[model samples]
Target: MARPSYLARRAGGRYFLQIRLGKRAAELFQLPLLRVSLRTSDFAEARRRLVDNLGWVLELIEAPDLEAIGTVFDVRLRAYVDRGSPADERLLAERCAFENEVRRYFTRAQERGYAYQKRFPEIPGRWVDFVDQNKAAESSITRLTARRSYEAGRREAREAFNEGWEPAPNKAPALRPETLDPIAMLDRLVQDAVGRRMAQLAPGNLAPVAAPTIVPAETGNPNEPAKSDGSTATTPDRMSILLQEFLRPAGRKRQHTMKGRGEAEAVVQFAIDFLGDPRIDELTEEKWKLLDDALPDIPNRDNIPREFSQTLFQRFKYAETHGWKDLVRVTTTTIQSRYWGGLYKFLDFVIEQKLYAGPRPKFVCIDPENLAPLPRDAFDDTELLQLLQQPLFTGCKNRLHVWQPGGYFVQSHIYWGFLICILTGMRPGEVGQLKCADIRTDGEFYYFDLRPFDARSGRVALKDLRNLKTNAAGRVIPIHPILIELGLLDRMQDLIDKKEERLFPEWEAYIRKDGTVRWSQPLSKSWQYVKKLLKLSRADLTLYSTRHLMADWLDNEAIAQRTRDRILGHANDVRGRYGRKGILDPEIAAKIEALEPAVIKQMRKMLLSAKNRADAGGLTVLKTY
Candidate 1:
């Protein structure tokens, strides 16, 4: 029984390692398809290597004796050899292909029960190895085929092949092209596209694509958006506050956000270095100078926009107006410099994020200490009567004639927005974002629903309203007469009747050129105009001051601490849901409305008649420590 083995054979004609097998090779016969001339290689090493190695091969194959033995001894080997075949490449290859052909021939031989084993040969090695290895292997088939002299005729074919030889060509070269500039080619393509598409549109082709125009790339397509190509572009004008502010969208992947941060920081760092604060001033000086110095040379891309800077300044002025001046007073040696520095950084952040423009804010704070030097005869009682005679604001366009009758358009409407702010104490953002639908007048109360607003660019660019400044900032405040007189009730009713969502329009203006709009002006202009007309100047008073005024007004009148806090968007200790929206209960409206108009009107009349109440001898708290 031959052992299992590795087998290889020629498909055409050749002698090759056919089956490597051993003494225990009977497993070959188990395979029904395996039928062969079970003969050995004429080469001695072929028998020893292949046959001797079958033990190792048997460990791998799961088949039992018959399949293994038949495959190794007969299905693979072809042992017919014409006497004197030489070993050569032509001989080896032809035989390699031929041996397998001969192996296949044996399947026919077995069925015929022929006394002969035949070989159709291509090269010499097959017949030679059959003679040599078989003699050494003494395989069972060799013993059988020997008595049959008819097989020797089949082995003579290989002797004809090695006698004729030829060589194959190995090397050849083809012509090729010279230059390849992939980037330059892409650039040219983009340029061609831009030139072709950028001509004036035919008609009705007016929609801003999500994409901004593509500028030619420095190397290729300038219009392509910035890629993380380790590149930089510089510009002289630094007005794009958002570019400077360089804020990335919140909650982006670290890799993406880091890239945005890098771009933002590049622009912002330039601005900061330009400010040169630390270098110009001594350490003792407000030391705003220290920021430029201390900031690491490398920073994430965070734009420090001008708008944010202006807001910080505005915030400071607001604080000063509200008796928080202790936070803003800047001085060379003021230990409070830290707060100012923070203010600067915060403003820088705001600018980069497009919160404000780059220019520092210029809004002034009113002095609580001085209100004197009034222009005499500015308005007599007779004038006051006429000013009062004008019925309070009605829902009129008034855009054409807001200054009608006495050019006191601002004065006429001052009481509208101003009084409400004083009564409600909502910040400007809250007030500006207001809408008519938000005001609620039900059974026995007035509720101002503070919702989202976006007056930037008059909502032409985009609608930018949101629910509240913060969850805590959202509140419903009970209204007083001022709210009613200001047309809030009518507006709310109009909205409800019409089923509209908006509460107010933060006013703006537009210009039409040739019956087509081209430009717009901020509507806050109208607000300012209204303030000027009233001649009622107060410290830190703006739309926001109303919220302050309301809080202080309530406080001065001895309103409960919990209630005052609730009115000012602060949490009320008496209630778990602190701040403005918590004050939404109808009960709060009843309480706010309960304030005597007589007291309010009296305070107003008295304050207006004089500059400093010291002349009227308003009491001052004397400190005698």
Candidate 2:
């Protein structure tokens, strides 16, 4: 026995010409199989039909280009539809003709059988009985009530015959020399696979044709340049790889910080997961819409448990013990900033690299106006005093290791960090990342320099490299009288004596996977602990509230708009821009330092009361503070 082809199959006592595709082909076609009944039980007839079908299949597979294959299939379909004459009309006509033919066949059979019965009366009990039976069958076909049922059976038989029948050259559309192009046919096949439903073709019996491998136009080797015609002949780049390239740090000028890059990666990874990690070129509008629709459903990590797992076993154990908790839902503002923001940037990169064909995607969903406005959690003087007097600032044993245990003494860095932020309006990260060298004094005034460390300076270790959030964030702010009065300068001197670089060395530095250090995390945790201890946990205030409070205070004081903008690292207006260069002027510094005497008095009282309380309790305060 000869080997059977993958396309040949026998079902219900009939041979079928089935199109069975491999996994890759099925994915490309978006279909698992294309099966057509040959309408014949004879193996020879099935083989002949298969041979006829293979001719076109082989031609399509062997096409030199997609364009050629597309043209062929387009012409074939047009010609086939044309042969039937306007499809609906021709189909109706064919059905009526088939019904009439079935009626005639029944009529002939009745007449011939009845005539035979009459001629040989002795052959049956009665010729009249045979004639009556034949008349009854004929009436069933002719009757209006039975007409629909009769036509249905006739239509089915006609369809079966048509499936097995091959129309002659004149009756059917001919494959013109121009239309025989295999490339055109394959292109059409692809279009059908993507744009619409695929048509099933009848099976034929012919010599087995091996399944042809289909190479998509967008696929290509990464290292190799694409063909001049803009076709790639290999695998396309994975979305993950493309995303990495898009988010990769360019140079010092355009480089994204480790945290920024990580956030961008997270956004892009969400898109990749939503799109099933399709090739970069395969990111269609439809798939993108799915991601957009699914954004609202994606569980947020806002309130999820923060567990530390250093090993696979530890991770597994944590999951097993904790199980999965309900994730917090993200807000529209988060979607706008994190999701749409990152996606729009990536789209720009894709356009810049010419990675995709046709027009670039317009990120209409990234509307800033869509983001809901949130009220700033500014603290009043009383709340500020309460926050400062918390255990983290006074003398709580460092239960969470968030702060250094100074016995009964407060961690001076955490104490001063909050105080400085309240007075200077500096961000938590900015305060946490301060270095001893950043605190400098001119003959006239003392100030803190908020600037990125020089990359060439070997003295500044990799983990100690200072990175400002933005260009506008780098500025010098005059040291508040309260900070100086509270011995902040003295603390800097002590750190310098120890040769420590960071201002707050006790606050642990968190090294991210990208080898960059984050100094703000511990301070943020300490603030949270403080909030919880002070019974202010339900308050909307965060460490950031200090900056808001300072802004409110400065605004109420009727401070110069320019001075306030400069102090807060906000974008300056045109008037504020005039006559300003690097390093603030002495006059402006004086104006910033001149805070209300009442505020200073309140701060001093709060600090003193906390200290006296700890002393009265016989707690051994760290001698330095």
Candidate 3:
């Protein structure tokens, strides 16, 4: 058999391996190249040892983060020192003896000054070389301390030599304060190795502890529930970790988009803050009740006093004592639906994943009477009049500040998103996520082919895989005549010409820290700013009001219920039955054209007026951020 390219024979007829590190691995190990002695002259034995060494190198390179890299190093160190044997004390003794010999060179009177310091400028390098020559594995931390110990040992040895002291070879030397403590370094590594071994054997030996335990004082809330004996019964699995597990494809049946995952995490994080991240097994009925009671205390999403409180628990406490009548609190509907609903899903996930071995914990019962979903307050005609005349729709000073008035008639996602929502009754999320490909022409009329880009469906490209809230959310809706007249079709053609993917390319996707991606964040933020400018004080009045307005218009027009449901993406329709082809496009377009003609005319009149004013002031189109 031939020797591998990485293998080489030393003068002593022993084989050694030399492997160059990748950039990440080099940075992590603080080494440019690694050389390991196979310690065998036979080519076959050297090849066998190469596999294990290469595997370790690969593990170091593949580690995700610093902590993970540290874990790999720790495992390597443990493997060297303990070897998974019952003779850990003996192993430590061997390490102690080796460290003692290493100290002798620095402690000798002849080797204490510039001559020795110049020879080994970096003690860690010398230590690494020493370990490599001896074919012993050592950790990076131990190597680092070696240099520190060398300098300390040299200082003390010089002082002791001045006092006419001579070192004895038979015994371990006593460490003075100025000396580097090699024993302490060895003790730490030994403890870590032994502790990990004990932990590996601990789980099977542990008996189940009692319930109704006192919550730890550091948790701040004394009433918070814990396990029996004032100690936790379960392992330390953080709520964030389990929540991420559930949000991923493997833990739950459904896989959510990045935005959906973020929303789920936010809700679960609230529970964690309230419950002190209690283990799944420790979540009792009383703990559940505490969360339920705190639900009412949670400030409304829009009304949270972020300046005063940080955590959900702190905000809840602040809401309890503050009796300002104007202080908006979360309603019964919000508590029953969002808060309780989120926790229920998480609890179900835990049980399904077998994270909790005991019977499922009972949640507080929400009264059927109070469980009704609240409809968002729709914008009235007056509110619409004020909102439509804003700088974004009419004209703005520049794209950077859409709220400021000027001659620049900027038309970006923020301008078109509101129009799309109001005219077509599409959700803000749906409108914001539209691609240029979603636009289609039927005969003489243009319409939105509103359907999710499912990779399985093969109807749309995988690259166009945007999220839909529900199966019913897949449907076609005709573009309103006002939008066609206002250059929407022209804009679509322009985007196609430019080969831009999204209809609104300026609106970038927002990614949360946990890696959930969301569109419409900027649109939503701009909408809030517009609302503030328009003096719309009601918290419930939002962009969704456009959908409500469209629904009311359709109802007042006496459009068919089925048609209205299809247009609004109501859950009445079967999942995949609608929006395949433009079968109902003509009928829907004709009906939309006929319904609210007066309102459409008024909107056209407002647009024309705004245009004339902007044109008189030298109208120019500018790009948005």
Candidate with maximal TM-score: 3
For model 2, residues 210-243, the per-residue Cα lDDT tens digits are: 4544444334334444453445433447676787
Backbone clash count, each prediction separately: 95, 19, 1
lDDT of each: 0.41, 0.60, 0.66
**Model 3, poorest ten-residue lDDT window?**
84-93
Error of 2 at 155 (Å): 80
Where model 2 places Cα greater than 4 Å from the true spot, the runs are 1-236, 244-259, 301-329, 365-373, 394-407, 452-466, 514-516, 537-539, 574-578, 597-599, 609-619, 623-625
TM-scores for candidates 1 onward, in order: 0.35, 0.53, 0.56
Rank candidates, TM-score, best first: 3, 2, 1
**Tens-digit lDDT track of model 3 for 96-193:** 33333234323431223323333333443334433443343334334656878999999999999999998776776776678678999899999999
- Over 4 Å off, model 1: 1-245, 248-271, 275-398, 406-415, 451-467, 485-487, 497-499, 506-527, 530-543, 571-588, 597-625
Name the lDDT value of residue 95 in candidate 1.
36
The global Cα lDDT (0 to 1) of model 1 is 0.41
Candidates 1 and 3 compared: the better one by lDDT is 3
Q: Which stretch of 10 consecutive residues in model 1 shows the poorest summed lDDT?
A: 454-463
The true-versus-predicted C-alpha distance at residue 387 of model 3, in Å, is 2.3
